[model samples]
Target: MNIREGKKEYLDMQIPEELHQRMNDVIKLDRKRRNERKVICMIKRTMASAAACLVIFAAGLNTSAAFAETAAGLPVIGGLARVLTVRSYHASEGDINLDMEVPAIENTSGDAAFTEAVNQEIEKIVNDYTAQAEQEFTAYKEAFFATGGTEEEWNGRQMDILVDYEVKYQKDPVLSLELTAAKGWVAASEERHYYNLDVASGRELTLSDVLGDDWKNIANEEIDRQIKERIAADPSASFFGYGDNELTEAKFTSVSEDTEFYLNAEGDVVIVFPKYEIAPGYMGILEFTIQD
Candidate 1:
Protein backbone atom coordinates (compact mmCIF):
# COMPACT_ATOMS: atom_id res chain seq x y z
CA MET A 1 0.00 0.00 0.00
CA ASN A 2 1.25 3.48 -0.90
CA ILE A 3 1.58 5.33 2.40
CA ARG A 4 1.53 9.14 2.27
CA GLU A 5 3.02 11.47 4.86
CA GLY A 6 0.73 13.83 6.80
CA LYS A 7 -2.18 11.47 6.32
CA LYS A 8 -3.74 11.45 9.74
CA GLU A 9 -5.33 8.09 10.58
CA TYR A 10 -5.64 5.40 13.23
CA LEU A 11 -5.53 1.58 13.33
CA ASP A 12 -9.29 1.20 13.39
CA MET A 13 -12.54 2.94 12.50
CA GLN A 14 -14.81 2.18 15.47
CA ILE A 15 -12.27 1.89 18.33
CA PRO A 16 -13.83 -1.08 20.08
CA GLU A 17 -12.94 -1.74 23.73
CA GLU A 18 -11.05 -4.86 22.70
CA LEU A 19 -9.16 -2.95 20.02
CA HIS A 20 -8.05 -0.36 22.58
CA GLN A 21 -6.63 -3.14 24.69
CA ARG A 22 -4.86 -4.55 21.63
CA MET A 23 -3.46 -1.18 20.65
CA ASN A 24 -2.02 -0.72 24.12
CA ASP A 25 -0.47 -4.15 23.90
CA VAL A 26 1.20 -3.26 20.60
CA ILE A 27 2.39 0.06 21.99
CA LYS A 28 4.13 -1.65 24.92
CA LEU A 29 5.91 -3.93 22.46
CA ASP A 30 7.01 -0.98 20.38
CA ARG A 31 8.28 0.89 23.45
CA LYS A 32 10.37 -2.09 24.49
CA ARG A 33 12.40 -1.62 21.29
CA ARG A 34 12.39 2.18 21.14
CA ASN A 35 15.80 3.73 21.82
CA GLU A 36 18.56 1.19 21.42
CA ARG A 37 21.84 2.35 19.91
CA LYS A 38 20.45 1.16 16.55
CA VAL A 39 17.51 3.54 16.72
CA ILE A 40 19.79 6.37 17.91
CA CYS A 41 22.20 5.80 15.03
CA MET A 42 19.34 5.68 12.53
CA ILE A 43 17.92 8.96 13.83
CA LYS A 44 21.34 10.57 13.84
CA ARG A 45 22.22 9.36 10.33
CA THR A 46 18.90 10.27 8.70
CA MET A 47 19.02 13.78 10.18
CA ALA A 48 22.65 14.83 9.44
CA SER A 49 26.14 13.94 8.21
CA ALA A 50 28.06 14.94 11.31
CA ALA A 51 26.89 13.41 14.59
CA ALA A 52 27.89 16.74 16.17
CA CYS A 53 25.39 18.67 14.07
CA LEU A 54 22.60 16.24 14.83
CA VAL A 55 23.55 16.27 18.53
CA ILE A 56 23.40 20.06 18.58
CA PHE A 57 20.09 20.11 16.77
CA ALA A 58 17.97 16.99 17.33
CA ALA A 59 19.54 15.84 20.60
CA GLY A 60 20.24 19.32 22.04
CA LEU A 61 24.00 19.07 22.61
CA ASN A 62 25.51 21.62 24.98
CA THR A 63 28.51 23.85 24.20
CA SER A 64 30.75 21.69 26.43
CA ALA A 65 33.73 20.36 24.44
CA ALA A 66 33.30 16.90 25.96
CA PHE A 67 29.83 16.87 24.43
CA ALA A 68 31.03 18.46 21.16
CA GLU A 69 33.19 15.44 20.26
CA THR A 70 32.80 11.66 20.14
CA ALA A 71 32.63 9.73 23.41
CA ALA A 72 35.38 7.09 23.57
CA GLY A 73 36.03 6.62 19.85
CA LEU A 74 32.38 5.90 19.02
CA PRO A 75 29.90 8.46 17.66
CA VAL A 76 26.64 8.94 19.57
CA ILE A 77 26.91 6.19 22.14
CA GLY A 78 27.05 6.85 25.89
CA GLY A 79 26.07 10.48 26.46
CA LEU A 80 23.73 10.21 23.48
CA ALA A 81 21.94 7.34 25.20
CA ARG A 82 21.23 9.50 28.25
CA VAL A 83 20.05 12.40 26.08
CA LEU A 84 17.77 10.17 24.02
CA THR A 85 16.17 8.73 27.14
CA VAL A 86 15.78 12.14 28.80
CA ARG A 87 14.07 14.02 25.96
CA SER A 88 12.47 11.46 23.66
CA TYR A 89 10.02 9.67 26.00
CA HIS A 90 10.32 7.00 23.31
CA ALA A 91 8.78 9.55 20.93
CA SER A 92 9.91 9.57 17.31
CA GLU A 93 9.49 13.34 17.22
CA GLY A 94 9.37 16.13 19.80
CA ASP A 95 10.44 19.70 20.72
CA ILE A 96 12.62 18.74 23.72
CA ASN A 97 16.30 18.31 22.81
CA LEU A 98 19.41 16.86 24.48
CA ASP A 99 22.54 18.90 25.10
CA MET A 100 25.18 16.37 26.13
CA GLU A 101 28.07 14.18 24.97
CA VAL A 102 27.77 11.00 22.94
CA PRO A 103 30.37 8.53 24.13
CA ALA A 104 32.43 6.57 21.60
CA ILE A 105 33.09 2.84 21.64
CA GLU A 106 36.68 2.65 22.79
CA ASN A 107 39.13 1.30 20.14
CA THR A 108 38.25 0.31 16.57
CA SER A 109 39.88 -3.04 15.95
CA GLY A 110 38.62 -6.61 16.61
CA ASP A 111 35.78 -7.04 19.12
CA ALA A 112 35.32 -3.33 19.74
CA ALA A 113 34.69 -2.48 16.07
CA PHE A 114 32.55 -5.58 15.80
CA THR A 115 30.54 -4.39 18.78
CA GLU A 116 30.03 -1.02 17.10
CA ALA A 117 28.88 -2.83 13.98
CA VAL A 118 26.39 -4.74 16.07
CA ASN A 119 25.18 -1.48 17.56
CA GLN A 120 24.63 -0.02 14.07
CA GLU A 121 22.70 -3.13 13.06
CA ILE A 122 20.46 -2.62 16.07
CA GLU A 123 19.82 0.95 14.89
CA LYS A 124 18.69 -0.48 11.55
CA ILE A 125 16.21 -2.68 13.43
CA VAL A 126 14.70 0.33 15.21
CA ASN A 127 14.27 2.32 11.96
CA ASP A 128 12.77 -0.64 10.20
CA TYR A 129 10.46 -1.35 13.13
CA THR A 130 9.26 2.24 13.29
CA ALA A 131 8.62 2.32 9.54
CA GLN A 132 6.78 -0.96 9.75
CA ALA A 133 4.58 0.35 12.56
CA GLU A 134 3.57 3.33 10.42
CA GLN A 135 2.90 1.11 7.45
CA GLU A 136 0.83 -1.31 9.51
CA PHE A 137 -1.29 1.44 11.01
CA THR A 138 -1.78 3.05 7.59
CA ALA A 139 -2.74 -0.24 5.99
CA TYR A 140 -5.23 -0.99 8.74
CA LYS A 141 -6.79 2.47 8.46
CA GLU A 142 -7.03 2.23 4.68
CA ALA A 143 -8.70 -1.13 4.93
CA PHE A 144 -11.14 0.34 7.43
CA PHE A 145 -11.89 3.17 4.96
CA ALA A 146 -12.66 0.66 2.19
CA THR A 147 -15.63 -0.46 4.28
CA GLY A 148 -17.39 2.89 3.55
CA GLY A 149 -16.81 4.86 6.78
CA THR A 150 -16.34 8.60 6.40
CA GLU A 151 -13.08 10.22 7.54
CA GLU A 152 -15.08 12.22 10.07
CA GLU A 153 -16.32 8.97 11.60
CA TRP A 154 -12.71 8.01 12.29
CA ASN A 155 -11.71 11.38 13.72
CA GLY A 156 -11.68 10.88 17.49
CA ARG A 157 -9.12 8.09 17.79
CA GLN A 158 -5.34 7.88 17.29
CA MET A 159 -2.72 5.18 16.91
CA ASP A 160 0.01 6.22 19.33
CA ILE A 161 3.03 4.08 18.51
CA LEU A 162 6.11 3.96 20.76
CA VAL A 163 9.33 1.90 21.06
CA ASP A 164 12.01 1.21 23.70
CA TYR A 165 15.23 -0.77 23.49
CA GLU A 166 18.47 -1.46 25.39
CA VAL A 167 21.88 -2.79 24.41
CA LYS A 168 22.64 -6.10 26.13
CA TYR A 169 25.86 -6.59 24.26
CA GLN A 170 27.34 -3.19 24.97
CA LYS A 171 30.78 -4.78 25.12
CA ASP A 172 29.79 -7.36 22.48
CA PRO A 173 28.86 -11.12 22.43
CA VAL A 174 25.11 -11.32 23.15
CA LEU A 175 21.66 -10.36 21.93
CA SER A 176 18.56 -10.45 24.10
CA LEU A 177 15.22 -8.65 24.08
CA GLU A 178 12.17 -7.90 26.20
CA LEU A 179 8.97 -6.55 24.63
CA THR A 180 5.46 -5.56 25.80
CA ALA A 181 2.38 -3.80 24.37
CA ALA A 182 -0.48 -1.51 25.46
CA LYS A 183 -3.65 -0.84 23.44
CA GLY A 184 -6.08 1.82 24.68
CA TRP A 185 -8.70 4.45 23.92
CA VAL A 186 -9.07 8.14 24.66
CA ALA A 187 -12.28 8.63 26.67
CA ALA A 188 -14.88 11.08 25.46
CA SER A 189 -15.73 14.09 27.65
CA GLU A 190 -19.25 12.77 28.04
CA GLU A 191 -17.83 9.47 29.17
CA ARG A 192 -15.52 11.27 31.60
CA HIS A 193 -18.46 13.10 33.21
CA TYR A 194 -20.47 9.87 33.20
CA TYR A 195 -19.42 9.13 36.77
CA ASN A 196 -18.08 12.48 38.01
CA LEU A 197 -19.88 14.25 40.83
CA ASP A 198 -20.19 18.01 41.11
CA VAL A 199 -18.63 19.69 44.12
CA ALA A 200 -21.94 21.39 44.96
CA SER A 201 -23.83 18.08 44.45
CA GLY A 202 -25.51 19.29 41.27
CA ARG A 203 -25.70 17.41 37.96
CA GLU A 204 -22.41 17.09 36.04
CA LEU A 205 -21.82 19.82 33.46
CA THR A 206 -22.38 19.47 29.75
CA LEU A 207 -19.99 20.64 27.01
CA SER A 208 -20.43 24.28 28.05
CA ASP A 209 -19.30 23.69 31.62
CA VAL A 210 -16.72 21.03 30.89
CA LEU A 211 -13.80 23.31 31.85
CA GLY A 212 -15.58 24.93 34.79
CA ASP A 213 -14.47 24.98 38.42
CA ASP A 214 -15.22 21.34 39.18
CA TRP A 215 -12.98 20.05 36.41
CA LYS A 216 -10.29 22.57 37.22
CA ASN A 217 -10.32 21.56 40.89
CA ILE A 218 -10.07 17.91 39.99
CA ALA A 219 -7.23 18.55 37.57
CA ASN A 220 -5.43 20.78 40.03
CA GLU A 221 -5.69 18.19 42.77
CA GLU A 222 -4.25 15.54 40.48
CA ILE A 223 -1.34 17.80 39.57
CA ASP A 224 -0.64 18.59 43.23
CA ARG A 225 -0.68 14.94 44.17
CA GLN A 226 1.80 14.17 41.41
CA ILE A 227 4.12 17.01 42.43
CA LYS A 228 4.05 16.08 46.10
CA GLU A 229 4.71 12.47 45.23
CA ARG A 230 7.74 13.57 43.18
CA ILE A 231 9.16 15.69 45.97
CA ALA A 232 8.65 12.93 48.50
CA ALA A 233 10.30 10.40 46.24
CA ASP A 234 13.20 12.32 44.71
CA PRO A 235 16.66 10.94 45.40
CA SER A 236 18.17 14.39 45.05
CA ALA A 237 15.66 15.94 47.49
CA SER A 238 16.09 18.90 45.17
CA PHE A 239 12.64 20.19 45.90
CA PHE A 240 11.04 19.29 49.27
CA GLY A 241 13.12 18.11 52.17
CA TYR A 242 12.73 14.39 53.02
CA GLY A 243 11.62 14.48 56.66
CA ASP A 244 8.34 15.55 58.28
CA ASN A 245 7.87 18.99 56.68
CA GLU A 246 4.28 18.87 55.53
CA LEU A 247 3.52 20.20 52.04
CA THR A 248 -0.02 21.57 52.14
CA GLU A 249 0.31 22.70 48.52
CA ALA A 250 2.66 22.81 45.53
CA LYS A 251 2.50 25.54 42.86
CA PHE A 252 3.96 24.12 39.70
CA THR A 253 4.43 26.71 36.97
CA SER A 254 6.49 24.31 34.84
CA VAL A 255 6.40 20.51 34.65
CA SER A 256 8.25 17.84 32.75
CA GLU A 257 10.13 14.62 33.58
CA ASP A 258 12.27 16.93 35.69
CA THR A 259 9.67 19.10 37.42
CA GLU A 260 9.86 22.44 39.26
CA PHE A 261 7.53 23.52 42.05
CA TYR A 262 6.90 25.79 45.04
CA LEU A 263 5.93 24.25 48.36
CA ASN A 264 3.15 25.75 50.47
CA ALA A 265 4.91 26.65 53.71
CA GLU A 266 8.41 27.82 52.69
CA GLY A 267 7.21 29.58 49.50
CA ASP A 268 10.45 28.71 47.70
CA VAL A 269 10.85 27.46 44.14
CA VAL A 270 12.51 24.05 44.22
CA ILE A 271 13.82 22.50 41.00
CA VAL A 272 14.39 19.20 39.18
CA PHE A 273 12.47 16.74 41.29
CA PRO A 274 12.00 13.34 39.65
CA LYS A 275 8.54 12.28 40.81
CA TYR A 276 9.37 8.62 41.35
CA GLU A 277 12.88 9.07 42.76
CA ILE A 278 12.09 11.63 45.51
CA ALA A 279 11.41 9.18 48.32
CA PRO A 280 13.77 6.31 47.65
CA GLY A 281 17.16 8.04 47.88
CA TYR A 282 17.12 10.41 50.82
CA MET A 283 20.74 9.66 51.68
CA GLY A 284 21.86 10.56 48.15
CA ILE A 285 19.76 13.71 48.46
CA LEU A 286 21.95 14.91 51.31
CA GLU A 287 25.03 14.38 49.11
CA PHE A 288 23.85 16.66 46.27
CA THR A 289 23.70 20.46 46.21
CA ILE A 290 20.03 21.48 46.28
CA GLN A 291 19.21 25.05 45.35
CA ASP A 292 16.20 26.81 46.84
Candidate 2:
Protein backbone atom coordinates (compact mmCIF):
# COMPACT_ATOMS: atom_id res chain seq x y z
CA MET A 1 0.00 0.00 0.00
CA ASN A 2 1.33 3.47 -0.85
CA ILE A 3 0.61 6.38 1.46
CA ARG A 4 -0.89 9.54 -0.03
CA GLU A 5 -2.06 13.02 0.92
CA GLY A 6 -5.65 14.28 1.54
CA LYS A 7 -6.72 10.84 2.69
CA LYS A 8 -7.77 9.48 6.04
CA GLU A 9 -4.99 9.65 8.62
CA TYR A 10 -3.73 6.21 9.52
CA LEU A 11 -5.10 4.96 12.77
CA ASP A 12 -2.74 3.74 15.48
CA MET A 13 -2.99 -0.02 15.29
CA GLN A 14 -3.72 -1.64 18.64
CA ILE A 15 -2.84 -5.14 17.58
CA PRO A 16 -2.05 -7.80 20.12
CA GLU A 17 1.58 -8.87 20.24
CA GLU A 18 0.84 -12.44 19.19
CA LEU A 19 -1.51 -11.45 16.36
CA HIS A 20 0.81 -8.66 15.28
CA GLN A 21 3.64 -11.12 14.84
CA ARG A 22 1.40 -13.36 12.74
CA MET A 23 0.19 -10.43 10.60
CA ASN A 24 3.79 -9.51 9.96
CA ASP A 25 4.03 -12.52 7.70
CA VAL A 26 1.02 -11.31 5.76
CA ILE A 27 2.53 -7.87 5.51
CA LYS A 28 5.71 -9.33 4.07
CA LEU A 29 3.71 -11.20 1.48
CA ASP A 30 1.86 -8.02 0.57
CA ARG A 31 5.21 -6.33 0.01
CA LYS A 32 6.07 -8.98 -2.52
CA ARG A 33 2.79 -8.37 -4.30
CA ARG A 34 3.44 -4.66 -4.37
CA ASN A 35 6.83 -5.20 -5.97
CA GLU A 36 5.32 -7.43 -8.62
CA ARG A 37 2.63 -4.86 -9.31
CA LYS A 38 5.27 -2.20 -9.85
CA VAL A 39 7.07 -4.30 -12.43
CA ILE A 40 3.82 -4.95 -14.23
CA CYS A 41 2.93 -1.26 -14.28
CA MET A 42 6.35 -0.28 -15.63
CA ILE A 43 5.98 -2.79 -18.42
CA LYS A 44 2.42 -1.68 -19.09
CA ARG A 45 3.48 1.96 -19.37
CA THR A 46 6.32 1.08 -21.73
CA MET A 47 3.98 -0.85 -23.91
CA ALA A 48 1.40 1.90 -23.87
CA SER A 49 3.96 4.49 -24.91
CA ALA A 50 5.19 2.27 -27.74
CA ALA A 51 1.65 1.55 -28.87
CA ALA A 52 0.83 5.25 -28.81
CA CYS A 53 3.80 6.08 -31.00
CA LEU A 54 2.82 3.46 -33.55
CA VAL A 55 -0.82 4.54 -33.57
CA ILE A 56 0.06 8.19 -34.01
CA PHE A 57 2.64 7.47 -36.71
CA ALA A 58 0.20 5.31 -38.62
CA ALA A 59 -2.43 8.01 -38.45
CA GLY A 60 0.04 10.62 -39.65
CA LEU A 61 1.28 8.59 -42.62
CA ASN A 62 -2.01 7.14 -43.86
CA THR A 63 -4.72 9.55 -42.70
CA SER A 64 -3.08 12.94 -42.62
CA ALA A 65 -0.42 13.22 -45.36
CA ALA A 66 -0.22 16.89 -44.55
CA PHE A 67 2.77 17.17 -42.17
CA ALA A 68 1.64 20.43 -40.69
CA GLU A 69 -1.89 19.24 -39.87
CA THR A 70 -0.69 15.95 -38.33
CA ALA A 71 1.96 17.65 -36.21
CA ALA A 72 -0.50 20.25 -35.01
CA GLY A 73 -3.35 17.85 -34.15
CA LEU A 74 -1.68 14.71 -32.82
CA PRO A 75 0.25 15.45 -29.63
CA VAL A 76 3.65 13.75 -29.40
CA ILE A 77 2.31 12.23 -26.19
CA GLY A 78 -1.27 11.23 -25.43
CA GLY A 79 -3.31 13.97 -23.78
CA LEU A 80 -6.84 14.68 -22.58
CA ALA A 81 -9.15 17.66 -22.68
CA ARG A 82 -11.25 16.35 -19.80
CA VAL A 83 -11.28 13.48 -17.29
CA LEU A 84 -14.31 11.65 -15.92
CA THR A 85 -15.07 8.69 -13.70
CA VAL A 86 -15.95 6.43 -16.57
CA ARG A 87 -16.42 3.35 -14.38
CA SER A 88 -16.84 2.44 -10.72
CA TYR A 89 -16.96 -0.66 -8.54
CA HIS A 90 -18.52 -0.75 -5.10
CA ALA A 91 -19.48 -4.01 -3.49
CA SER A 92 -19.05 -5.95 -0.27
CA GLU A 93 -18.76 -9.68 0.21
CA GLY A 94 -18.79 -10.38 3.92
CA ASP A 95 -15.40 -9.13 5.16
CA ILE A 96 -14.13 -8.41 1.65
CA ASN A 97 -15.02 -5.32 -0.37
CA LEU A 98 -14.10 -3.35 -3.47
CA ASP A 99 -14.39 0.42 -3.95
CA MET A 100 -12.89 2.02 -6.99
CA GLU A 101 -13.48 4.81 -9.45
CA VAL A 102 -11.85 4.12 -12.78
CA PRO A 103 -10.86 7.35 -14.48
CA ALA A 104 -10.67 7.84 -18.24
CA ILE A 105 -9.46 10.67 -20.42
CA GLU A 106 -11.74 12.19 -23.05
CA ASN A 107 -10.05 14.46 -25.56
CA THR A 108 -12.74 16.03 -27.73
CA SER A 109 -10.09 18.45 -28.89
CA GLY A 110 -8.53 15.69 -31.04
CA ASP A 111 -6.50 12.42 -30.95
CA ALA A 112 -9.06 10.15 -29.33
CA ALA A 113 -7.05 7.07 -30.26
CA PHE A 114 -4.12 7.76 -27.93
CA THR A 115 -6.48 8.70 -25.14
CA GLU A 116 -8.28 5.42 -25.69
CA ALA A 117 -5.01 3.53 -25.36
CA VAL A 118 -4.28 5.22 -22.05
CA ASN A 119 -7.75 4.40 -20.75
CA GLN A 120 -7.40 0.77 -21.71
CA GLU A 121 -4.08 0.58 -19.87
CA ILE A 122 -5.58 2.16 -16.78
CA GLU A 123 -8.48 -0.28 -16.83
CA LYS A 124 -6.15 -3.25 -17.12
CA ILE A 125 -4.07 -2.07 -14.19
CA VAL A 126 -7.07 -1.65 -11.91
CA ASN A 127 -8.51 -5.04 -12.79
CA ASP A 128 -5.19 -6.84 -12.30
CA TYR A 129 -4.46 -5.10 -9.00
CA THR A 130 -7.94 -5.83 -7.71
CA ALA A 131 -7.63 -9.52 -8.54
CA GLN A 132 -4.33 -9.76 -6.71
CA ALA A 133 -5.70 -7.98 -3.67
CA GLU A 134 -8.68 -10.33 -3.54
CA GLN A 135 -6.43 -13.35 -3.58
CA GLU A 136 -4.20 -11.92 -0.88
CA PHE A 137 -7.12 -11.15 1.38
CA THR A 138 -8.57 -14.61 0.99
CA ALA A 139 -5.22 -16.18 1.77
CA TYR A 140 -4.70 -13.97 4.79
CA LYS A 141 -8.13 -14.87 6.15
CA GLU A 142 -7.58 -18.59 5.67
CA ALA A 143 -4.18 -18.40 7.31
CA PHE A 144 -5.57 -16.50 10.29
CA PHE A 145 -8.11 -19.23 11.00
CA ALA A 146 -5.51 -21.95 10.44
CA THR A 147 -3.15 -20.23 12.84
CA GLY A 148 -5.75 -20.24 15.65
CA GLY A 149 -7.20 -16.74 15.25
CA THR A 150 -10.65 -16.71 16.85
CA GLU A 151 -13.87 -15.59 15.17
CA GLU A 152 -14.22 -12.60 17.47
CA GLU A 153 -10.68 -11.45 16.75
CA TRP A 154 -11.25 -11.68 12.99
CA ASN A 155 -14.56 -9.86 13.07
CA GLY A 156 -13.35 -6.54 11.76
CA ARG A 157 -10.65 -7.71 9.36
CA GLN A 158 -12.07 -6.30 6.16
CA MET A 159 -10.17 -5.79 2.93
CA ASP A 160 -11.47 -2.41 1.81
CA ILE A 161 -9.74 -1.70 -1.47
CA LEU A 162 -9.84 1.85 -2.82
CA VAL A 163 -8.86 3.59 -6.07
CA ASP A 164 -9.45 7.24 -6.79
CA TYR A 165 -8.14 10.21 -8.77
CA GLU A 166 -8.10 13.98 -8.73
CA VAL A 167 -7.46 16.72 -11.25
CA LYS A 168 -4.52 18.73 -9.96
CA TYR A 169 -4.68 21.23 -12.79
CA GLN A 170 -6.91 21.88 -15.79
CA LYS A 171 -6.23 25.09 -17.64
CA ASP A 172 -6.83 24.94 -21.38
CA PRO A 173 -4.03 23.01 -23.07
CA VAL A 174 -2.35 21.95 -19.80
CA LEU A 175 -4.03 19.30 -17.64
CA SER A 176 -2.63 17.41 -14.67
CA LEU A 177 -4.20 14.29 -13.14
CA GLU A 178 -3.23 12.29 -10.08
CA LEU A 179 -4.34 8.70 -9.53
CA THR A 180 -4.11 6.99 -6.13
CA ALA A 181 -4.51 3.36 -5.13
CA ALA A 182 -4.39 1.97 -1.60
CA LYS A 183 -5.80 -0.64 0.76
CA GLY A 184 -7.97 0.75 3.52
CA TRP A 185 -6.69 -1.81 6.01
CA VAL A 186 -3.12 -1.09 5.06
CA ALA A 187 -2.91 2.66 5.32
CA ALA A 188 0.85 2.37 5.76
CA SER A 189 1.31 1.86 2.02
CA GLU A 190 0.08 3.63 -1.15
CA GLU A 191 0.66 4.13 -4.89
CA ARG A 192 0.26 7.24 -7.05
CA HIS A 193 0.50 8.17 -10.74
CA TYR A 194 0.67 11.67 -12.18
CA TYR A 195 -0.19 12.70 -15.73
CA ASN A 196 0.52 16.11 -17.22
CA LEU A 197 -1.18 16.72 -20.55
CA ASP A 198 -0.31 19.56 -22.92
CA VAL A 199 -2.74 19.82 -25.80
CA ALA A 200 -0.77 22.69 -27.32
CA SER A 201 2.47 20.70 -27.56
CA GLY A 202 3.38 17.12 -28.42
CA ARG A 203 6.15 16.80 -25.81
CA GLU A 204 5.72 16.15 -22.11
CA LEU A 205 6.44 18.97 -19.69
CA THR A 206 9.68 18.79 -17.67
CA LEU A 207 11.24 20.63 -14.76
CA SER A 208 13.54 22.41 -17.19
CA ASP A 209 10.46 23.64 -19.04
CA VAL A 210 9.12 25.14 -15.84
CA LEU A 211 12.28 26.02 -13.87
CA GLY A 212 14.83 26.39 -16.66
CA ASP A 213 18.24 24.60 -16.73
CA ASP A 214 18.86 25.12 -12.98
CA TRP A 215 15.83 23.00 -12.04
CA LYS A 216 17.72 20.50 -9.90
CA ASN A 217 19.44 23.10 -7.75
CA ILE A 218 16.31 25.19 -7.35
CA ALA A 219 14.18 22.16 -6.52
CA ASN A 220 16.67 20.78 -4.04
CA GLU A 221 16.96 24.07 -2.20
CA GLU A 222 13.22 24.59 -2.13
CA ILE A 223 12.51 21.08 -0.88
CA ASP A 224 15.12 21.37 1.87
CA ARG A 225 13.75 24.70 3.00
CA GLN A 226 10.18 23.43 2.98
CA ILE A 227 11.09 20.29 4.88
CA LYS A 228 12.59 22.36 7.67
CA GLU A 229 9.69 24.79 7.66
CA ARG A 230 7.12 21.97 7.79
CA ILE A 231 8.92 20.27 10.65
CA ALA A 232 9.03 23.56 12.52
CA ALA A 233 5.35 24.10 11.88
CA ASP A 234 4.51 20.66 13.19
CA PRO A 235 7.00 19.32 15.73
CA SER A 236 5.54 15.81 15.39
CA ALA A 237 6.23 15.66 11.65
CA SER A 238 9.73 14.62 10.57
CA PHE A 239 11.54 13.90 7.34
CA PHE A 240 14.38 11.39 7.35
CA GLY A 241 17.93 12.71 7.80
CA TYR A 242 16.99 16.33 7.20
CA GLY A 243 18.17 17.58 10.59
CA ASP A 244 18.52 15.63 13.85
CA ASN A 245 16.26 12.94 12.36
CA GLU A 246 17.71 9.47 12.24
CA LEU A 247 19.25 8.37 8.95
CA THR A 248 17.23 6.00 6.85
CA GLU A 249 18.05 3.75 3.93
CA ALA A 250 16.40 6.31 1.63
CA LYS A 251 16.98 10.03 1.98
CA PHE A 252 15.91 13.10 0.06
CA THR A 253 18.22 14.05 -2.79
CA SER A 254 17.85 16.31 -5.78
CA VAL A 255 14.97 15.97 -8.20
CA SER A 256 15.60 14.18 -11.47
CA GLU A 257 13.96 14.19 -14.89
CA ASP A 258 12.06 11.07 -13.80
CA THR A 259 10.97 12.55 -10.49
CA GLU A 260 7.21 12.63 -9.74
CA PHE A 261 5.62 16.04 -10.19
CA TYR A 262 2.47 17.85 -11.30
CA LEU A 263 1.19 21.32 -12.06
CA ASN A 264 -1.27 22.74 -9.54
CA ALA A 265 -4.12 25.13 -10.26
CA GLU A 266 -1.89 28.05 -9.35
CA GLY A 267 0.43 26.85 -12.15
CA ASP A 268 3.02 25.98 -9.50
CA VAL A 269 5.08 22.83 -9.99
CA VAL A 270 4.27 20.47 -7.12
CA ILE A 271 6.90 17.87 -6.40
CA VAL A 272 5.47 14.69 -4.87
CA PHE A 273 7.22 12.12 -2.67
CA PRO A 274 5.75 8.75 -1.83
CA LYS A 275 5.25 7.81 1.78
CA TYR A 276 8.53 6.64 3.34
CA GLU A 277 10.37 7.82 0.21
CA ILE A 278 11.98 10.67 2.12
CA ALA A 279 10.17 10.61 5.43
CA PRO A 280 8.66 8.24 7.96
CA GLY A 281 5.49 6.48 6.82
CA TYR A 282 3.56 8.22 9.57
CA MET A 283 4.02 11.52 7.78
CA GLY A 284 2.11 10.11 4.80
CA ILE A 285 3.03 11.47 1.38
CA LEU A 286 5.14 14.62 1.21
CA GLU A 287 4.63 17.44 -1.33
CA PHE A 288 6.55 20.64 -1.95
CA THR A 289 4.96 23.36 -4.07
CA ILE A 290 7.57 25.32 -5.98
CA GLN A 291 6.39 28.88 -6.30
CA ASP A 292 8.11 31.70 -8.10
Task: Give the Å shift of residue 168 in candidate 2.
Answer: 4.2
- Tens-digit lDDT track for model 1 on 60-136? 33444554353343333433221122123433222212222222222211223443543454445444644555555
What's the C-alpha lDDT at position 226 in model 2? 93
Q: Tell me how many residue pairs clash in candidate 2.
A: 7
Q: Which ten residues in a row have the lowest lDDT in candidate 1?
A: 188-197
- The local distance difference test score of each candidate is 0.33, 0.65
Which ranges in model 1 have alpha carbons more than 4 Å from their true place?
1-110, 166-292
Per-residue CA lDDT of model 2 for 6-113, tens digit only, reads 255545545578997789988887654443211111111123444554455555555554643434453333322457788887989777677777777755434556
Q: How high is each candidate's TM-score?
A: 0.27, 0.66
